[model samples]
Target: MFKYIKNDLPASIVVFFVALPLCLGIALASGAPLFSGLIAGIVGGIMVGALSGSQIGVSGPAAGLAAIVLAAIATLGYENFLVAVVLGGAIQLLFGILRLGIIGYYFPSSVIKGMLTGIGIIIILKQIPHFFGYDPDPEGDFAFFQVDGKNTFSEILETVNNISPGATLIALIGLGILLLWSNVLSKKGKFFQLVQGPLVAVVIGILFYVFTKNNETLAISADHLVNVPVPEDASSFLAQFSFPNFAAITNPAVWLTAFTIALVASLETLLCVEATDKLDPEKRVTPTNRELLAQGTGNIVSGLIGGIPITQVIVRSSANIQSGGKTKASAIIHGFFLLISVMLIPRLLNMIPLSVLAAILFIVGYKLAKPKLFKTMYQLGWKQFLPFITTVLVIVFKDLLWGIGIGLAVGIAVILIKSYQNSHFLHIEGEDVDDGKIKMTLAEEVTFFNKGAILKELDKLPENSYLELDVTKTRYLDNDIIEILEDFSTKAKNKNINIKLISERGIVENPPSYIEFFKLRPKTSV
Candidate 1:
C-alpha cells in the first residue's frame, strides 16, 4: 500500500480538499448536524477505504442520499435515523455475502460512459455558481433541482448578478495557477509533480484571503469560504458525536428507512465502482461484493458515532484519479486529513476559498465530458451513441440514478430493436419466382424478444410452400417461441405448406409435437 506513497500522499491531499466541503454540505443538505458529515467522511475514508477492494475509489457522505436522509431524519428523528443507517450497513453486508456485486457488471458500457460524461457536465455546470462566489446552495448538490429554490441555469444567472469581485478574482488566479502547475510546471520536474496543482491553488487561495482581509473589493467573505466546525475545547468537541437509539430497531418505519438507504447506497456505490474502474489509468477491476462489505461496515461505524449514510462517490474518486492517486492509501490518508484538520487547524481551513475548489472541480468536469468524446460516441453509431447521449442528457436534466435508469431503458429498447431485426434469416433456395421453397434459420439464444420477427417471417410464407425451420445453431430457445412454432404448424396444414424441423438431434418431417421433441433432447442440444 505504501509502494506509491509519493503519489498517494499528494493525491490524498487533493481528495482531502475535495471531500471536506462535500462532507459539510451534504450534512447540511440532509438536515443533519454539520459534524456528522465530517464523521461520515472520516469513517468512509479510513474504514471503507481500508476494507474496499478499489484502488482509486473514495467513499464519503453522498449528495445523492441527502434527500432521503433528510426525509428519514424528519420522520424517524436523528437518533432513530442512526439506527436505520446501522441497519442499512448490515443489509449491505448481506448483499456482499450474497455476491450481488455482479449487478455492477450488468450495466451496459455505453450507459456507464454516459453516466461519467453526464456527471462531468453537471459538475461543471453546478460549480460555475460557486466559482463566481454565489453559493446559496450547499456544496455537492448535483441534482438539477437544487435544495436551494433555483435550478442549475437559474443559479448560473444568479451568479452573474451577485458576483463577488474578491471571490471571483481569487478564483481566476487559482484557476490560472492550476493550469500553469498542471500544464507547465508539473512537466518541468519531479518536485512540481510531487506538489499537486490543487494543493497549490488552495494554499494561494488561503493566502489571498489572509492578505486581503480588510480590502473592500478583494476580500472574500465567510459565506464564500470553507467552513469546518471549530471546537472550543475537548469536551465540546466530544459533544458533537451522537449515538443511535437501538430501541427503535423494532419499528417498521426504521426498517423501511434502513432498506431504502441500503438499496440506494449500494446502487450508487456499485455505479461509482463501475465508473471509477473505467477512470483508472491502470484499469484495475474493483471487487463489488467486497466494496459492499466495506461500505456496510463504514456506515455502521458512522451511524454509531452520529453520521450521515456513506457511499463510494464518483466525484471524489474521479478527483483522486485525476490527481494521480495510485492506491487505497490515498483514500485512507484523506480520512486522516479530515480527522486531523477538524481536530487541530479548522481555523486555518476556514480561510480557504470555495471558488478555488470549484476551479479544481471545473477541470475534473471538463476531463469527464470532453467534446471529443461526443464525436467518438457518435462515430460508434446510434446503437452505442444513443444510450451514451441519453444518459448524459438525462443525468444533466435529472439526478444520477434517474439518468442511469432512463438511459438503461433506452439501451434495452435499442437491444430489442436489434434483436427483432436479427432474429432470423430467410433464403429462397433454387429461386424460380413463385416456386415457394424457403429455409428459415433461427438465431442463437432465441428469446421471447424475437417472437414478433419469427411470427412475421412465418406469416410471409406463400401457399403450398415447403418451409425448413432450422434450430441447429440455437441455444436456450424460449418456450414462447416454441409455442409460436407449434401454432404455425396448424396454419401450415391449412395453407398447404410442408414444414420440416431441423435440430442437432435429427430432422423431423412436420413434427406433430415440437414441445415433446425439445423435451426429449438434452438441455445442451436445445
Candidate 2:
C-alpha cells in the first residue's frame, strides 16, 4: 500500500479538499449539526478507510443519504437519530458477516452507470447555488431546498440576484487557475504535475481574498468564507460530542432509521466499490464484504461519538485516484487531517471560502461527468452503452438510488428481451454446407426468448436439407424452447429436411417422432 505513496499523497490532498465542502454541505442538507458531517468525513476516511480492503476506495458522508437523514431527523429527535446510526452500523456489520457483499455483484452494470451519472448531475445542480454564492440556508442548510420557501430553481435565480460579486470573480479566477493547472501546467513538467491544481487555486483564492479584503475592488466577501463550526475553546470543542441515547434503542422509529441507513449506506458503499474498481489503475479488486464490515464499524463508532453515517463516496474516492493516492494511507491521513484541522487550526480554516471550495468541487464534478467519459462508454458497445446511457440520464433526472433502480430495471429488461429472443440460430456459428449437410452450435442456454429466433433458423432450411442442431454444450433448455423444436421437427419432416438435436439431455436414440424426440420421460414418477 505504501509503495504508491507518491501518487497517493497527491490524491489524498485532492480528496480531502473535495470532501470538506461535501461533508459540510451534506450535513447542512441533512438538517444535522454541522459538526456531524465532519465527524462522518473523519470516520469515513480514518475508521472506514483503515478497515476497508479497497485500495482506492475513499469513504465519506453520502449525499444520497442526506434526504433520508433530514427526514429521519425531523421525524425523530437528533439524540434518537444518533442511536439509529449506531444500530445501522451494526446492521451493516451483520450484512458483511452474512457475506451479502455479493449483492453488489448482482446489481446490473447499467444501473451502476445510471447511479454515477445521476449523482454527477445532482452535484452540478446542488453546487451551482454555492458556486454563485446564493446560500439560502444559514450556512448550514443541507436539504433539497431552504425551508424559507425557496426551491432549487428559485435558488438558482437567487444566486444570480444575490450573487456576491467578490465570490463570483474569485471563483472564476480559481476555476481558471484550476483549469490551466490541470490542462496546461500539469503537462508542462513534472514540477507542475506534482502540484495539484486545487491546492494552487485555493492558495491563490485565499491570497486574492486577503488582498481584496477592503479594497472595495473585489466581488467576493468575507461572509463567503468556509464556515465550519468552530468551538470557542478546547473543552467546548470536545463538548460537541453527543453520546448515544441508549434508552432510544427501544424506539421503533430509531430502528427504522437505522435500517434505512444500513441499506442506503451499504448500497452507496457497494457502488463506490464497483466504481473504485473501474477507476483503479492497477485494476485491483477490493473485498466487498470487508468494505461493509469496515463501513459498518465506522458508522457504529461515528454514531457512538455523534457523527453522521458514512459510505464509500465516489467524489472523494475519484479525487483520491486522480490525485495519486497510492494506498488507503492517503485516505487515513486525510481523516487525521480532518480531525486535527478541526481541532487545532479552525481559526485559519474559517478563512477558506465556500466559493473557493465550490470551484475545486466543480473541477472534480467535471472530471467525473466529462464528455469524453460518455463518448468512451458509447464506443464500448450497446451491451454496455445501453445501460450506461440510461443510467446517466436516470441519475441526472433523479437521485442516485432511483437512477440506479431505473438503470437496473432497464438492464434486466434488456437481458429478458435477449433471453426471450435468444436462439441456437442467431447464435450459431461456423456453418458449412458439405454434401447438403449444415452444422451449427447452440448457446449454453435456450430459454423461451430464443424460441422465435431458433424457429426462424429451422424454417429457413432448404428442402431435403440435412441439418444438425448442436446442443452438446447446452446445459438448460426451457420447455417453451422444447415445444418450438417439436413444432419445427414436424415442419422439417414436411419440408423433406432431416433434423438433428445434438445434446447430452437428448430424449431419443432413434425411430422417434417430434413428441417422442425431445421428451425424455421422467424417471420413477412417484
Q: What are the lDDT scores of the predictions, listed in order? A: 0.88, 0.75
Please give the distance, in angstroms, between residue 488's alpha carbon in candidate 2 and its true position after superposition. 42
lDDT of each residue in 447-508, candidate 2, tens digit only:
44454456556657788887777766665454445544655555666778776656665523
Over 287-378, each residue of candidate 1 has an lDDT whose tens digit, in order, gives 88999999999999999999999999998999999999999999999999999999999999999999999999899899899999999778
Instruction: State each model's C-alpha RMSD to the native.
Output: 14.0, 13.2
For model 2, what is the alpha-carbon lDDT of residue 231? Answer: 86
Q: What residue runs in model 2 are displaced by over 4 Å at the alpha carbon?
A: 137-154, 217-219, 376-386, 423-526
Error of 1 at 252 (Å): 0.9
